[model samples]
Target chain A: MNIDAFAFDFQELNKEIKSSGQEELNIDNCMGQRYIGCGLSRGSLRIRGVPGNALGAYLNGADITVHGNAQDSVGDTMNEGKISIHGSCGDTPGYAMRGGKIFIRGNAGYRAGIHMKSYRDKCPVMVIGGSAGSFLGEYQAGGRIIVLGLGSDQPCPVGYFCGTGMHGGKIFLRCGQLPASLPDQVNAKLADDVDLQEIEEDIRQFCAEFDLDRETILDHPFHVLTPNTKNPYRQLYVHC
Target chain B: MQIDYFYPEYEVVRNKEKCTRCGLCVSQCSNHVHSYSEEHRRMITDDAKCVNCHRCVCVCPVGALKITGSNHQFKHNANWSRRTIMEIYSQAETGGVLLSSMGNPKDMPVYWDKILINASQVTNPSIDPLREPMETKVFLGSKPASIERDENGRIRNNLPPHIALDVPILFSAMSYGSISLNAHASLVHAAVDLGTCYNSGEGGLHDDFYRYSANTIIQVASGRFGVHKEYLEAGAAIEIKMGQGAKPGIGGHLPGNKIVGEISKTRMIPEGSDAISPAPHHDIYSIEDLRQLVYSLKEATGYKKPIIVKVAAVHNIASIASGIARSGADIIALDGFRGGTGAAPTRIRDNVGIPIELALASVDERLRQEGIRGNVSLIAGGSIRNSADVVKALALGADAVYIATGALVALGCHLCRGCHSGTCNWGIATQDPALVSRLDPEEGRRRLVNLVSAWTHEIKEMMGGMGINSIEALTGNRLMLRGVGLNAKELEVLGIMHAGE
Candidate 1:
């Protein structure tokens, strides 16, 4: 089923997409249409042109492939699904994600992978191909965030205040130089062999999805950040 | 052991002449406030442990027990009060943030009491509610700005998904860990029976209560605890909990002791780990960011259910509501400062957030002025005690009101203000199995149903008295309301005129 996105309300488009019998939707000319494939499960979506904010939000088990750029809040609070963006995505990608994979072929904006969590077998994985903006993975409780500086011009791959309030989970930045002001609550060091193995399959899939050299991306030194203590707010409050 | 330094705030008097000594209070009190001393052959009261919940007073075989404010006052000074001094002592004793339960009980101005309702006297005849068909049923959702019709000249319903209710009342969010499983069951059953809805707070939906999904509204707070695809699908709607009235700008903290077997499974955390909901949704830093989240939930639910953005009533609420209305939210639920909480820092609960009455009025006026009132339904709450408050809230512009403290009160909550302690003598706010069993859900369900139904009847009658047969006719009809003791600013802010003017 193909829906031409022209002069149609986002709500109307969504309603039609949901009520339609077709499991595969090809939305063309999606000029900044917001909330495409939201909360949808058991579907395959191919979106052309720029999709607006909250693309595939709360998306449950839907596989969305955006051929062009996406605006802010891509995959916000998405539970289980796969969002593959071939172009650069805007801010807050894969935020509060519980289980899913968000593969951005290009750079991501600020606060990507913030508050993403994981349960028993469900670990949400976000792979940003290029450099990410500031406050990356802020207050992340669970899940995995991988920022591979495959192609970026900045002196550092990530901007200021990366993983500021991160408590649980791990943030892997494949960069040589690190930010000067990482919060003292977290530990940032060279990725161990165990950490590399854990993200090996995700890196492989991200590379295959974007047609990148997997070995080259992985050959770079990676830095993994995890909360130093279980109590992140130990020094935050004065007890009284 | 901690030294005993302060006197109790309440004194329990038991009339020995009428005492049968049935030992009900001794067993029923979860705080162990009463015990039958063998040496005295009489029940001795422990005032220090008592929260004045009135469990003993309610359960006493005879009318033999009464609790009153203690006369153990310190030397009075105009600048220093007893409570302030004691609070300082307690904080000094245990260098921890003082936690309290329930709403603010300070002597703040209650705007609800200042407003008055007008009844038809002459020109408009009052309708008989009992004899006539009175429509109290309300549907909460975004209404289309203009009606759309099919090409065949047929009316097309283009409105979004709505939460339909027999009356304009909803049970506000109270987490399972904060309250009890039996309490949740009671609320769920009562909501189902009354054709209303109750919230699951920040706690994940308990597996057993999944059967009552139709009457449930699963809330997504900052914690995202127990938030999964199944949990999102299990409710009629999803509420984005940005803030609560009791503790605005603060995250929720479910103490480790409250995280038991079922709670652990529900929240998807360990058995004894503290569950904390962060202060803000890191994704939503701005109101436009709020729009992103609102759409996210809508997308997640497949646009099948309404998405409510619940916020604490703040100083600049009207503008906040205007932004939320534009954010594609189906409903905006406002909670005032007096709203109940499972637990909150005492200082924050009392001092933070604004009154619901003012927030409701200003937000409604702003939305209507912006011609966006139809875009979102409004629900106001905090301390709506009766049907009149419901009527005033509607007349002031709320589509409906969320009731929590009032609902809990109907279930035998005596406002003991010890909910954070988690040893609720009435079994209304505790997770203890023994204490929880005291509150039979069957009986609780009946009581809640009765309370809501009776309030519905009162609201209908109030509407009829105002010469309005349908609730829609009374909604945002400021002519049906008038200010009594309110000043110019108060009246102007409320958009209502003084009586006889």
Candidate 2:
């Protein structure tokens, strides 16, 4: 199915896309058409131009490949499936996403993977090839976030206040030095051989998807951050 | 163990002749004022532990208890009375916390009471609610961008996804940890029986109430406790709790002491860990960020459920509601300052936000001005007291109203303003298993259903008297309301006219 989104409103275009009965969708001239392919399952969407916020949001078992940069809140609160972004993405990339894998080939804005959680068998994964802005993985309860600085030259690829209130989950950053003022609630250390082995598959996949050398990426020192305790705020508010 | 102290204000006295020595008061008192002595074989009172709630006086079988002011009297003056002097002295002793409950008990102007409803006299004939088919059923959701027709000129997709209600009233959000399981069960049962909805209040959905998912609105606050796939998919709608009216700018903190067993399991946290919902959703910094969350929930729910944005009524609410309207939300729930909470700082609860009435008026006007009134349905809450307030709220342009205190009142909450203590005498807001079991879901649900049904009938009657057979016509029809004693500013804020010319 081939549709020009500039001609119709998002609702009309979405209705045509849903009713077209085609497994493959090629949306051309897509400009700020929000909620495109939203909750779409069992289809392959290849977006041509820049898609709006929440593209492929709550995408359940579908494959979405965006040709260009994506807007804010991409794959927000998503449950499953894969969204491969060819260019850079916006803020809160995977906000509260419980499951599925979001791979960005370029830089991501602030609060990437904020409030991302994991359940019994569902662990949401977000991998950014470039640096992330401030407040990375803020309030991250569970899941895995990997930031592999491929082309960036800065000594520290990630921004300030990384893992500020993080109580769960593990963040792997391939950087020379960790942030100077990491919050007291988080523990940061050099990724050991076992830690590198755990994320080797994800890193290999990211390298394979974006066409990067895996050895060059793995050669740099990586820092791993995890929450200090299971219950970080147990003694803060009330007299228990 | 006798300790001498100065009695500043009041004392509790017991009439020995009327006292039956049943020892019920001894166990009921939380402050340990009354006790049973084995040697004396009778009950004894320790006067220092009394706060003068009059509970013993009211509960005494023979009216044996009375409270009196101790040696604290004012000189005979025309301007001041003894009670006034005692009140000041009591405040001085207690260091001026000024705890209260229900609504504002101060002598300020209650605009809802001052505003009068108008009925049809001659031009338009009034209809009887009992006889005529008056429409009380309301659906809260986005109206639609535009009701367009196909090439055949037939109606196409007239309804947006909405939660249909038999009555306009719904049970507001009171989490399981804040209240008890029995109280939550009673509310769920009442919502089912009355064909309305009850909010899960960010505590996460209890496993036992999965059968009542259609009548539930699962909440996602900053804490995101117990928010799993099943919880998200169970509810008819998802509400993002941005701010609560009782304590705006403050997050919810169900203390570690209260998080026990099922409450802890449901929230998916440790047994004694504080379930802290941050003041703001750390992710959302702007309206665009808010849109991301709204759509995320929509995506997670497969776009089958409508999303509701619940925000406290604050200053600049009109503009804030405009942003919410454009945030892809189907419903906007505005809570006023007088809303109830289990626990809040005393200062924030009393003097923080504006009234729901004024907020509703301004939001309605702003949405209509933006020509996006049909895009999002408005549900006003915080302090919707009775059927009359419901009618006036509809006239002020609310699609529906949410009620918490009123429903609790039906379940025997005495409005004693003691929810913070976590030992609700009525068994409505406690975690203790023994206390929770006192409120039977069956009877409590029946009482709530009765209260809402009675209010619905009254709403229908009021609409019928106005010659408005449908709730849609009654909405935003400010001509049907007139202010009786409100000043010009109050009238202007409420968007209604002063009484007669």
Best model per lDDT: 1
lDDT for each residue of candidate 1 in A1-240, tens digit (9 for 90 to 100):
898877667887777788886889999888887888887777899998888888888778999999999998888778888999999998888877888999999999998998777766778999998889999988787789998987786656888898887777899989887777899868989888998998999999998998988889888889999977645654332111
Q: For model 1, how does the per-residue alpha-carbon lDDT over B170-270 read when each residue is reduced to its tens digit?
A: 99999989999999999999999999999999989999888888899999998788887788889998999999999999998775567789998888765
Candidate lDDT (C-alpha), each: 0.87, 0.82
Over B7-61, each residue of candidate 2 has an lDDT whose tens digit, in order, gives 5344778888888889877866665678888999877888756655555676788
* Candidate 1 residue pairs that clash: A38-B299, A39-B299, A39-B300, A61-A80
The Cα RMSD of model 1 versus the native structure comes to 3.3
What's the residue-level lDDT of B365 in candidate 2? 92
| Worst lDDT 10-window in candidate 2 chain B | B1-10
Candidate 1, CAPRI quality class derived from DockQ: acceptable
Candidate 1 residue runs with Cα over 4 Å from true position:
A1-30, A46-49, A152-156, A175-178, A211-221, A229-240, B1-4, B14-24, B34-45, B62-65, B93-95, B268-274
Instruction: Give each prediction's root-mean-square deviation over alpha carbons.
Output: 3.3, 5.3
Docking class of 2: incorrect
